[model samples]
Target: MDDCIIIGAGPAGLTAAIYLTRFHLSIRLFDCGSSRAALIPCTHNHAGYPAGVAGTELLRLMLEQAEKYGATREQAEVTAIVPVAGGFDVQIGDRTAKARTVLLATGVVNNRPDMDPAEHDAALQRGLLRYCPICDGYEVTDKRVGVIGTGDHGMREAIFLRGFTPDITLIAPGAAHELDDACRAKLDEAGIVHVDGPCTPIRIAGDRIAVETPAGPLTFDSIYPALGSVIRSKLAVAAGANASQDGCLEVDEHQRTSIPGLFAAGDVVKGLDQISHAMGEAGVAATTIRNLLAEQRPIRR
Candidate 1:
């Protein structure tokens, strides 16, 4: 049994483990070693490193920092989480570890196009298609861009894209009338073009993305997929934690979920899903867990 068990080795989980280990808490981290952060080749927006750094390198440094604090890292997939008498049991492979607390930082997987590498390689390599506006929106200033996705998230991304580019199009795979009057009005006021119906196949050539739509084959400098993430919240949800419509866990300022002894951060929780935000949430969660554990200690007579 350990004081804490953190699932996922991404920024949020690693940061939480580092903080908890520094507090002299025994912590174990379970990870599948798949972080969306690896998709980024170079990141210039993250604070610190004036010259910027490679995403893989930054992740490596974070892992090193966590290990230096005595946090045990194991490569394993967490199949399930079961509540026990005093805490929780984490099922990994055939083994189960009981912990007083658990932090779920397992991030979401971005839904990407299933295009062949040779076809979409250039576009993917050049950042023509992006998933995170908070990370790459600034780079699209004054450029014609198209966002693919439907529903509230798509509408929200379209609004956010307006900050960087006026020539923006929100391509929904469904009927335009599916949006409420307020959202439609906002798009109209923003001068954003809305195209309904299925997205035409996207063809990447040189530096432009040629998307075939019912309107016509539209060419844009960039395409953003605002499709919601498939957040892994079943473990926490099964433990009686609340979640949003998109399946992201609901947490408080302390990053504690509705379930006692269970906490979550990063994309798994409702937020901007940025590295900085994730790290901040992890710090808060670590402090909260530490306090909870301290309070549980028996007082000597």
Candidate 2:
């Protein structure tokens, strides 16, 4: 049995493993290499990278850091997490691992526009598509950008991007005229032009991205999908953890969930979905977990 079993290997899970191992706690970190962090082109909001860093490069460095502390990593997916006598039984394929504590750092999957697998891959890698305005809005400063979504998420993204540039447009390609009157007023107040149409296949070029809508062909330097993400909190939720409507888990100040030995952090738990925020949350959760384990005494013979 290990002291802790951490699910997900993004900034939160990796950071927690590093901190836990330093306390001499045995940990097994499971990851499937599907972290959204690796999809980012370059993140400048994360601290210490003044010049910014590619998401894949940042993930690699953190993996090395965790491995340096002798942290064990399992390249498998956790199918389920069942609470057991001591703590929890983590199901990874045909095997189960027992741990005195569990940390769920499974991040969310972003909602993106549909395209051919290869074309989408090329567009993302080429940095013609973007996400998380908060992470790289400055990079799009004074540049033409489009928010390809609707409802509150889309409206908020356009308003957020307004801070970086006034050349922002909101596109409701599939759901034309879906924005309510209030939302339209808000967009108008923010000076965001709304284009309605069921757009055809998106065309990506070296210099820009173009979407052929019924209104016309709209092109932009980049487009952000504000449709939100699918929170990977099924394990926690199945174990009786509370989650918001958006499926984000609820955690206390120490990142403890409704279950005592089961805790959560990072994008899996409710809060800012930033790398810095995730790391800070992991630090708090790891320290608190250390204190929790210290109170356990061995059985007397």
Q: Give the best candidate by TM-score.
A: 2
**Candidate 1, superposed: residue stretches over 4 Å from native:** 113-122, 174-177, 298-301
List, in order, the clash count of every candidate structure.
0, 0
Q: What is the lDDT of residue 228 in candidate 2?
A: 80
Candidate 2 lDDT score relative to the true structure? 0.87
Q: Model 2, range 1-301, lDDT digits (tens) per residue?
A: 9989999999999999999988878899999889999988788788888888988999899889888989978789999999989899999999999999999999999877866678777777766788788788888899999888887778888999999999999988585757888989999998999988565577796689888788888898888877688999999999888899989998889999999899898999888889999999999999988889888843222
**RMSD, model 2, all Cα superposed?**
2.1
In model 1, the worst 10-residue window by lDDT is: 112-121
lDDT of 1 at 202: 81
